[model samples]
Target: MIPSFPVDVERIDPLLASEVRRHYDRGGRTISFCSGSFLLATLGLLNQRTAITHWRYAEQFKQRFPHITYRDDSLYWYDGRIGCSAGSAAAIDLGIAVIRDDFGYEYANAVARRLVLPAHRDGGQSQFVQKPLAPVNAALAKVLDRAVKHSGSGSTVEQIAAKANMTRRTLDRHFIRHFNMTPHQWLCERKLEVARQLLETTHLSVEQIAGRAGFDNAVTLRHNFNKYLSVSPTKYRQTFKSSQQPF
Candidate 1:
């Protein structure tokens, strides 16, 4: 069962929490969506179990329940009879999984088809999380913005630093402080995001998309896609493309 939010586990009536626990105690399969995991944790239902929740709430979950294994990178996790999902879309994925387990793959696939969703998504929450730039000084923010705008044009870190009137070392420092990543890493993620979008929305060939996304070639794009997303570009397109048209 899913709990409604604004979840205040601390303010929830003890009897209500006990009733929820009793539901689980009676062999009820529980699926917690997003912040609902907090309610389950309050009832000790998630203790020693691997769970996932919205990435934005991951830190708070960790702080509150250090004993539970919190898998922040997964869209959802199924541990025996208890399951948890990352967010709204991920909750749909978890529901599909439940259907698959209860019936079979064919039933789950049919349900997914009816919903116009993929039967399963590859990779994890990292692929869906917004990689926001760190709030930095105004000058650095402008520099980062320029880099993002030209990400598809293969702008180098040196060029970005020059635009910011800073040395390479200074640029690296600012990037670490503001983004927790080197300039190169941030640029690669930006390019990959562009490539993923193009793959989903367009029928561009891999080579064409690679050029548009600032990769050297289709091979490079494949390598990076596999490394970062754990799926090939073609496979990613197949999974997320809205239409059944041949690529």
Candidate 2:
């Protein structure tokens, strides 16, 4: 980005790919706005890092860099050292966040209002999605996500299939075609991811987490966590959780 403060504009050309790598290696804050994420990827700064770009370009980004964990379908993603904004306008939100970090909320809000935009946002994408997908797809996603959202006490593939008015075979085929994963595999991964995020962010008891995450019991939760993460919930929390970020 053009520095907020004054710098010789003529010197911008001297900033090379190698220089960007040095900055990333030194653990400095680095960001790319929408398509600009390519600059980082082109320079190899995204190795082993999870990042996002706009949805339209996700496949191209992945095809170009198969080694990196590019999750551009999301509105945004922030790894510790690098961050990427999704759609072009999301850059404004990222800018506001940066201003808030560097200055404060007052300054960020003033800048946002002066720019004729909202002050802040709480969740992910706000814009309505363009495509018209099926309710069955959404219901399936809800059931899969429900493992974490409602703690797995609700919903299963058979239940989802019944609600979607499809047979089990049809649902299984759809899951394979769209997600390249079986229903059980997808559910397990989704549950584990939710459990990890919760463990890292909250002080919820294991029993509560199990209940909320649809693990049936703490024993099941512990078993799944160990199988996937190679660490127990308590140990994983101790190692990974430093602070929580609210949704």
Against the reference, the lDDT scores of all candidates come to 0.76, 0.63
Give the residue spans of candidate 2 off by over 4 A: 1-12, 15-19, 46-79, 84-86, 89-150, 177-180, 189-204, 226-232, 239-247
Q: lDDT, candidate 2, residue 168?
A: 88
Candidate 1 clash pair list: none
Q: What is the TM-score of each candidate against the true structure?
A: 0.59, 0.52
Where is model 1 more than 4 Å wrong at Cα? 1-35, 42-64, 70-134, 244-247
Q: How does model 1 score by TM-score? A: 0.59
Give the 10-residue window scoring lowest on summed lDDT in candidate 1.
Answer: 121-130
For candidate 1, write residues 207-244 as lDDT tens digits: 99999999999999999998887779898777666554
lDDT of 1: 0.76
Backbone clashes for every candidate come to 0, 4
